[model samples]
Target: MDLKNVDLNLLVVFNDLLNTGRVGQTAERLGMTQPAVSNCLARLRRLLGDDLFIRTQQGMVPTPYAEALAEPVSYALGAIHSALNQSVVFDPARSRQNFVIAMTDIGEIHFLPALMARLAAVAPGVSVSTVRNLSIDLPREMEAGNVHLAIGLLPDLQTGFFQRRLFGQHYVCLYRHGHPLDHPGGMTLEDFTAAEHVGVVAAGTGHGIVDDLLARMGVARRLRLQVPHFVAVGHILRNTDMVATVPQVLAQCIAGPFGLSWCAHPVSLPEVSIGLFWHSKFHRDAANQWLRAQIVAIRPDGVDGGRTEDGATAL
Candidate 1:
């Protein structure tokens, strides 16, 4: 347990073994002989008092202790690497780095296209990966460095994280342009409740917002279909008479091309705030700051402010 007595290089070997699963492959990756790698593993086992990894037909299986250590150890190593890699000046034009983000399909639809275009033009060498939003522990994921950024509507973010508002979104009723409801120019609560509705329920605060709004107004729609993503709602609206209440930006993107029309929600709904979240550990990272700035810059105007209870104006 004494950190000063342990060799840091052994952890690197341990990580390689865990990743490659085969001792020979681990040795090759580390440019060491198989015997040396085996010796290092033995030393690690003795030091940690655990087997760490058990060989399996499929691959190396981490012991419970190793599983517990994996995230923290990997995170520590990553932070060390980032600290060592820091430069006095960041040169975006030539740097090759990978950034991992966690966002819902809606966020991907609205934010990624322009963001990728900008990155392609300015920082062509940078790479991006996105993971679907799930009801998992986001704070742990961010703290462990599994995700560099989390962008979406957060109900109650943990205190240690850094949050920056990227945009605001309001709900709008979307239907096919020539659908039966289009003639009225706008929908009333009666019409909305009568029409077939498509609903999207994603992780975080999305579903509750719609439900709360409906409860407040003493109105509820006949939900004919339920899907997990807003992107699917667009497709369903294109081919059917069912209308969906979706974020304004998403509706705007699909309305014209899909022969869709949008009207203000019949009952007032609270505006949803979309923000970019990251751990405080990365708050001062130059590349992270640049990426956040790019996201904020490309967000649609008038959607960056806080909303009120009645959804009248930004606070």
Candidate 2:
């Protein structure tokens, strides 16, 4: 097959078929008549030299060849779309670009507000959407052009992507401002273990780093609740005597607004390194570079005015 002779639009039909499983539904999704979609699929079959999909009792099922090609083909289409949409020179003041980012709730609380403020001053028309960073395949997502940027503590990222360390976040113990723990100067390990706790277990498998650290030291707390998101932990801590361990930056941000007080975690926990990540394909992209520079500039400075081992500012 001559690759140059292929029309890229066939991939669109291919993707639609894969997603919807029925020709009629695929046609509706692509905003094309059923016959047109069928014609396109036929052409695709001729070019690929195989029946990409077969009629099944359930719906249209992809052949083994189609299944093998799905990810790479989708990535190719997405990259082409991004390249075509790329502006030669990005003027934030006048350009209207919608950026999608994958980040944790903690990231939203600490970074997004400042980022939005900067965007408002520069590119008022620019918009951003945040999605949950639950998947471990972020590098693949970046390569596929599904996500423009990702921000979080991804310590084990593979090669072929660029990462800029943003900051180091340690754990902090948080409780209501007037809680009994606030009677003295600060909380001690004994006070922390004695209190009722609300554990934020976003991943659902293991106890958080704080809890893990305590367990290593043979200390355990009365964990009254476990929630998926840090936001819920804050809500519960505000209304009850349940204390929770949260990222220091996130705790600082919510402490004032929610009438919460924070102290350093009694047991030493590993600091999470938050960073900005992007694909290497976008390394020389002018707009991507500009956005990256702006993000780095807006990040908070280091504690000792030097970068940490993870290349982020010490917090």
Candidate 3:
């Protein structure tokens, strides 16, 4: 694997081939002839000592080896692409840079509206994309510039990244307004544990702490349904007797639309700290700094407006 011997264009062809799985389609995307794509694939086959894609009647199916190489190669290409496209001067008002953020469904519901509103006012051309990758390695994605920032309570992102504390939140018991359980007195430990609950199986988030905290307190929830995300929880609670234990920010976000009410958790759950995480790799990238500033404004408490790790107070 001598880097000096390999052609960069071949890797680009390999990536597009791996995505499109056809010489003609790959050529169409890369603006090259089919022969050129096939030639590049040949060079890649010799370099890697494997037939990366096997052509079938349907399409080119990746071999086991190619499957293994797909993610890393895409990341490498993405890092190179990001590096090449980095702007020296980021004028948010006119720049059409699209920032990719990694967050959970909870963040989409809770953070996006405020963020987009701010972006529309200041940087109308700046676009945003959000990804919720529970299985993804956040650090690797950030390192490759695939994800510009991650907003959540991802403890896994603690090491090898710079983060700004956006807010800390506690769990709340959310249910419909007219439910039998909804009361001025709020949820008691008995109501929390005995009620049929919709347990959100949010794998890579701070909400997991709620279940752990309940376990420690010797409390049990009668889970009637389990879901992977929180976007549907409020809807479910609106129509069913099930209550959900979720972050206060999320509860607040969903409450109005679904006619829901939330109260203090009876079981004394610890506050889960949420933050804006970014790799130091793009700390000084002007576009990155500007986007980070917009996110800091949408903080749950909306007070802390300071310099990010990039050392930029405002764009």
Candidate 4:
């Protein structure tokens, strides 16, 4: 338990091994030799008094003890990184940082175009990449500095992280422009529930909330098609007869491009709150701060002084 006697560099190797699950891959990622990585693992196992990972046909699998240590180790490294780089200056135009953001396909359509354009004009040297929210261990990745920020209606991230509300949106039923349900007066409840629906069943996403709400109100959708994500919703709805209930921002972004249209949901559903999220470890990091500012500048009309029940507004 003596911090000065133990090599903290081994923890970096340990975290990489936890993520990659392969010694060779971890070595490559950390710019070390395979034997060096193996030595680090050995050192870590000795220091921790357990075999952290075991080799198997699948890959190097972490033991239960290692799984338990993942969060604390990641957080410790984050704090160490924050402390060491506190005085680093970030010049957006000169920096070649590639930021990884977590979001859904809905976010790509609604935000990326404007965001990329803004980056091109201001921080041309900087680039952005995205991973699907909730598809991976987002919290761990953020703590490990793998994911810089997450932009979406991510409830899981509301706690133990800092977030700034981007916007508030409601659900709208989307369909082809000339579909029968595309009426000016809006479709009645009976018609809405009876119509064949294109349901989105993305795991742990806010889209499922509306479905649960309908069920609570004793309304059932005739789900003719169920998709894992909203990436293909617009394309499918543009050519099909089925309608989908989605965030109003997503609908607006796709309606014109996909030859689609939307109307307010027939059933009352709570509003969706999108936010800009990052781990507290990177709250004051210059590069992270600049990235956040860029996102805010691109869409400043979002809730400036709003606070969510989860304390998710700029904390």
Candidate 5:
């Protein structure tokens, strides 16, 4: 068969035939006459050299050849339909989309409560799945549509990524409520350096960001223990006499419940900013835009600041 001579409408007829089975129903669905559908099916049979559908009292049963063609033909037509409908308005309230987000546990602690409440009230049918972005290949995941958004401090994104800064987190010193340093004046520089510390390392090795900043200032804390996750800090601080220099958000999150109190860090350190990131492949995608808008709307201060170097919204 000549490729250029083949009628693509015949493929559409074949797809509808595979779906509805009865020629009358297929014609009604395609908005065509039954005779026109039959003609297209006949042409499809001749082009493929197969009787495609066998008419029986049980309705039209697909032949082995038609059954083999079913999946690819359906997928191709679905892709084409999606491509043509790219500009359609996305209605989140009725959509059953599952948005996958890549984030650290810290990000989950700070972001999930409000996000879930918003989803429950607005887009209830939309579900969310979270994957920790430790060492995962995020660029490949985003490009393949496996990851919809990445939340938290992702400083290593390559060229095609977009981001929006949600807030900046300053460093603070967290310790048990009564083990001494909860004075009115807070811990002094000497008292901070002398205290035994609990270190949380997200990088899986070496010291944390606080340590690097302190090292630059010719000061070092006595780190008696080190852990990889942020959740452990509360328990460790509550039971032990050790102190932790952590992001203010995390310190505040774990402080009250664990009988811990936090004060401003004695040393100067750069504030860590958290952001929402996604691949540019989804920049103009309607559903993605809806989700991003929801996130931006609930930002802590509800203010649009400046833009980051990579064109991310800063707030």
Candidate 6:
């Protein structure tokens, strides 16, 4: 456990392995030979007294001990990197940095076009990639630098992360413009519960924010259709007698184009708070800070700052 005896460089290899899960790729990323990377892994195993990674058919699968070490090691390495490059200048126009973000389909629809346009005008050399927010290991993914930021209604984040409120959302029921429920006062909690519903499962738990709220109120709608992506909800509603409760922002953007009409939820539900979340490790990184600022600039008004009794907002 002597700090002097440990080669801190192994942590870099370990961090890369966590992201890439392959020694050859990790070696290429770190500019080291494959043999040298293997050597480093051996030393790391001895130092930590655990088989950090095991080769498998899929890839180098990390052991439970390795999974536990990933966060702190990546955090420490990132802090060291930030400290060393504290004076480094970031010019988005000239930098070819690729940023990966985690967000839901609805967030992408509402945010990406504006964000991409802004970046294209100013930071032509920079590119952004998005992955689904259904990743259960989002905090760990951010800590490993795989996900630069997660933008959505993320209520699962615990400590070791930072969040900034972007906007508040409320539920709105959407249906075809000519559906029976489109009439005034025709849509109620009773009508909604009895109607055929389209369920958009956004999280890994196979439930969306709307479903969670209904469950809290001891209500369950008849789910005639279940889809994992939000984009499909519009199509399903336009073609069926089903209804869906979605974020108001999403309804505004998609309702008109999809030949649908929307109204406020008949039942009271907690407001949805959308935010930008990132691990504390990247809080001081110049590129990450710039990206966060860009996201904040694109944020709409009426951001609800309400927090749950536990101080965490539920998605």
Who wins the TM-score comparison? 4
lDDT of 4 at 160: 44
TM-score of 2: 0.72
In Å, residue 252's CA in model 4 sits off its true spot by 1.7
| 1-315: candidate 6 lDDT, tens digit per residue | 888988888888888898888889888878999999999999999988999999998789999999998777876887787788767778998999999999888888989998999999999999999987565467667776778988887667756777877887788899999998899875788888888998887765223656776798888889888887888888889998899988888898899899999998988877887778887777777888889878877876733345421343322
Minimum summed lDDT over a 10-residue window in model 4 is located at 300-309
Candidate 2: Cα lDDT at 103: 82
Which is superior by lDDT, 1 or 3? Answer: 3
Q: Pairing residues by index, what is the TM-score of model 3?
A: 0.72
How well is each residue in 82-185 modelled by candidate 3, as lDDT tens digits?
57767678898998888999999988988898899988999899889988867565665675567899988877775446788788888888999898888888
lDDT of 2 by residue, 1-315 (tens): 678998988988897677677899878767899999999999999988999999989889999999898767765765665587566778889878888788888778877889999999988988888877565446555654567777777544545566777777788889998999976568888998899998887662122555677788898989999888887767788899988888888888899988999988887888876777776556556677667766776776633325432453211
Residue-level lDDT for 9 in candidate 3: 99
Model 2, residue pairs in steric clash: none
Better of 1 and 6 by TM-score: 6
Reference-based TM-score of each model: 0.70, 0.72, 0.72, 0.86, 0.69, 0.84
Could you tell me the lDDT of residue 145 within candidate 1? Answer: 56
List pairs with backbone clashes in candidate 4.
none
Per-structure clash totals for the candidates: 1, 0, 0, 0, 0, 0
| lDDT computed for candidate 4 | 0.84
Local distance difference test scores for all models = 0.77, 0.76, 0.81, 0.84, 0.79, 0.82
How many clashing residue pairs, candidate 6?
0
In candidate 1, which residue ranges exceed 4 Å CA deviation? 1-88, 302-315
Output the better candidate (2/6) by TM-score. 6
lDDT of 1 at 188: 85
The number of residue pairs in model 1 that clash at the backbone is 1
Query: Across residues 268-310, which tens digit of lDDT does each residue of candidate 5 receive?
Result: 8788877788766566677887888787777776776476334
